[model samples]
Structures are given as structure tokens and as C-alpha cells.
Target: MAHFNKAFQFKTRSIIVLLTVFGFQLTAQNWDVPADKKAKNSYIKFDKTTASEGEGIYTKNCASCHGNPSKGNVLKSLKPTPPDLASSGTQKLTDGELFYILNTGRGLMPSFKDVLSESDRWKVIAYVRSFNKSYVQVLSNTDPTKSDKVKVTMVYNHETNTVRVQVVAKEQNTSLPLKDAEVLLFAKRYFGKLPIEKGLKTDESGVANFVYPKDLPGNKLGEVELLVKVNDEVYGEVESSTKLKIGIPTDKPGLTQQRAIWGVLAKAPYWIIALYLLGIATFGVFVLYLVKNLFDFWKKGQQ
Candidate 1:
């Protein structure tokens, strides 16, 4: 009886531990978004027009998993699965809080600070909040705090085959340079932007240098768009872009790409080609035989 009691106690403890872990996982997702000290209420008013504009941004950047507005369906294969932004799980977050999340993504979500321009991200927030109709008027009435935006210039050096980046943060009201800001560089690819080099902090002169690939793969035209961005830990994000000429696209298929299952007809196995030819020949013969039989029947009727 004692041995059975000991086993029962062990099983009970195991079940309790499992339940605790499961409960924690469920609870954590609710408050998983980190606080953004820079986050503040949006000044931009929410309206059907603003939300419609935001819908364009959201569909392109967010709809893959969250749910496509066009299709009205979402991908559910992810482990935790992306939440429906229109639902209470996301609608409950304030406009500022939602903006912060878009700026700084958590877990499987990606930060759109660099992917999207500052105004576009705000536009997306407007579209998302439109799902709840209560805050439309309140958002328009609230005053917004203005923050300093950054300006970045990129010059590609042909002699050294490197990119020279200059980042200057200045208040929109005052054009004077703000020093010691962090800047990031990104090269646009077919699917998305690929970040190159570590984030650099500007010097006293507000200049930072980076080495970009001299032969980065690109489209058939060999053009790669380079982006320089700065996301302030305290303020808003700003960015600039310049197109650079890179190496030609590497999409030209090799000889190895010419064979097997999905290969061109010329690259197909001789036997398969022969079978294809035989099928055509057999079809031709079948038609000819039927024609011959019909002619013979006509002749016999005439006789």
C-alpha cells in the first residue's frame, strides 16, 4: 500500500508540474510585448481613408500569417500560430503600444522599422485599429509628441568598392546635426532586404563607414537598393535609400539544372523522348487506320 501511495504521489507531482508549465506558456503570450519608453499616443487621426491606406501596408507586410484581407484566410501551421490582429488579443493594445510592437517585433514577428517607413508603419496601425470603432474620434483629438528624425546619406566608392554612410539626426524644426546616433545598413534583395555589417554609432562628425559587397547578387539589371536606417531607442525611426550597381544575377541555370524530373524536353531521358514520339506516332496511326476503315466501308457500300 505504501509503494502504491508513493507512485500515486509521484504521478500527481508530475501532472502538477506539466500543468504549471502549460499555464505559464498561455499567460506569457498575453503580456509578451515589451514596453517601449519611446512609445506615445499617435497624432494621426484614424478614419476610413487612413485605415484603407494602412490596409495596403498590412496586407503586404503582415497578411501572410496574421490573415490575408484579400483571401480572408490565415496560415495556421506555425507552432504558436499568429494571432488575428483584428481580434481582442491585439485590439486591446493602445495605438502607441501597437506602434511600438510594429517598430520592435517580438518572437516570430519581424520589426518593420527598417522594412517600412515611419509614416507607413503608422498607417498600418491606423488600419489595424479600425477594427475597433471606439477610438476613431478620440485618436484625432489627442495631441501628439514630435520627435527628432534622422537623415542618412550613402556614397558608394568605386575606387575601394565600399559604401560610405553618413547619418545625421536633426530635429525637423531645427536642421542642426545630432551626434552619437546608431545607424543600420540594408541591401535589398529579391524577397527582402539583407542587412550588411553591424549597427554603427556615429562619431562627433555624425559619419559612419561600412564595407558593402562589391559583387552582391542582384536582378537581371544588376541593381541593388541600399537602405540606411536609424531607429532611436527614445525617438522615432528614420531612413534613406540609394540604388547601387552590383554583379549580374546568378539566376542563370547551370548544366546541372538542365536534367532529371523538371528538366526541359531536350534534357529529358532518351527513353522518355522516345516514348513521347511513339505516343504521337501511335495516335497518328490510329487516326489513319480509322480513316482507311471508313474509306473501305464506303467502297463496299458503293459496290
Candidate 2:
């Protein structure tokens, strides 16, 4: 009986230790997302209607901290304030990462999984991305099969430093060169589409040429998405995206390039600051001198 009790105690202690360890591990995990969730592709496509809807939802739910520039955040005074979602750092994150962040809020951000429908959350991201040009999303019909039906090919020429985009229209499970199709090469900018020139019709080869400049700015990863679109009246509009290494990141601003709404004395040049202080002091002295002269004139009038 004593042996039996000893065995029972050992088993209970083992279970307790294991449970304790497991709990510690959970606490230490930092709320990391699983690999599968991080790899998920978003079902939502960018469209004006969806974005507008997203804007509304964002204004209602998120604008207090992350929506408008002037009033984007009411929670700015929170202990861990929400970041400006439109900034370069937040814009560089992949769609999946953003989606996960939205799905599971961290720190000061509350999880919208309870408050917002999943689809509405995605719209909010679309609206937030709109503030910056590079994060500009491509609009397409939500029908997955349509995007799959069209094929787009893009090639970069190292010698000429140009991009060649070929778009083929698919019909009846056959490949055909879509000639004279209205094609536009869109370089994703912060706020809107920057057409690579004027919109051009594809030639007999269904190919359009873009002079990719080496100096063109990209995201923090030194990459740019060249969005190729073929708008067909009957066949329906189709689009494809290709990533290019365009070198320097344009999203990040330089010291000299930053615009300050509210200025601080520390940011001013030493000489400029000295002159400003001197000017203020001189103005104060002049005011005092005028006040003294007025007092003397009043006393003389009284005499």
C-alpha cells in the first residue's frame, strides 16, 4: 500500500511539472502567429467600392488612433500608442502580416475579431494603405477564377534597364495574343496610380514596353510592383502584378526631406535660432521703450 501511494504521488508530481512548463512556454511565446496564418493570401481584392466602404468602417472604428492625419488617432496618448499605419515602416509589411495583425491585436491595439467582421477588417487595411502611394492596391473583381484565367509575363532587361510586359487574353482554354487591347502600366505610388506614360494599346505581339529607370524609388525592401492591366469591354478587365528590384527605397524620408507641422527649437539651425531669439528680445525692448515714452508724454500733458 505504501509503494502504491509513492507511485501515485510521483505520477501526480510529474503531471504538475509538465503542466507548469507548458504554461510557461505559452507565456513566453510573445503571441506569435503560426507559419500557416502568416502565409495566407488575402481573398479581398482592391476596389473603389470596397475601399470606400473600408474608409467608412475605418472612420467608425479606427480613425481615433490610425485613420486621419490630423484626427487619425484619439488614442495617441495611449501607453503604447498606435503607429501611423500609412508610414513607411508599417507599409513595408506584407498583406498577410497586416492581416494577421488585424486578426489578433497586440499591446494597445484591441482585437477586432470580436468587434468587426473579418471582411470589414480587411477593408480598413485598404483604407489605411491609401494614405501612401507605394501601398496603393490594385482593384479587381472578387471573382478568383477571372484572375486565374488571365496570364501576365514580365521580363527585365539588365542592359537597357527596361521592363517588357506581355499580357495574353485567355479564352476557351486556349492561349491567344491579345492585340490592340487597352493596356496601362501602373507603378504603385503612395496615394494613386502613376501611369508609366500615357495608356497605350498593345501591339500585334500583345507586348508593351516600359523604360524602367534605375533611380525609381521603391519600398523598404528595394522592390516595386509593376501592375499590368488589360481593360476589355466584353472579355472583362484583367490584371497581373510583377515585382522588380528598383534599388533605393522612396518610402523612407531623409532628414532634410521631413516636413514639420510643429517646429521645435532643437531642429532649427544654430544661427537661425540665435537670430530668432535676438529678434524677439529686440521687439520686447522696443515695446518697453515705447511704453515708457508714452508714460512720459502723459505725465507732461497732466502738468
What are the clashing pairs of model 2? Answer: 64-73, 64-74, 65-73, 68-72, 132-190, 133-189, 133-190, 133-191, 134-189, 134-190
Residue 246 deviation, candidate 1, in Å?
39
lDDT of 1 at 303: 100
lDDT per prediction?
0.71, 0.70
lDDT of 1: 0.71
- Model 2 scores what on Cα lDDT? 0.70
lDDT of 2 by residue, 185-273 (tens): 88787667677766667778878777776777887788888888875433445888888876467668544444333336666666777
State the lDDT of candidate 1 residue by residue for 1-303, as single tens digits: 999999999999999999998876554375444443233556567778888999998888899888953234667776466777877767777766777778787767788888997668878888878777565433333222333355677787777777777766466576544355567899976467889888877677777778777667765567678888865444445678988775566665544456555568878777888899999999999999999999999999999
Clashes of each: 0, 10
Candidate of highest lDDT: 1
TM-score of each: 0.45, 0.34
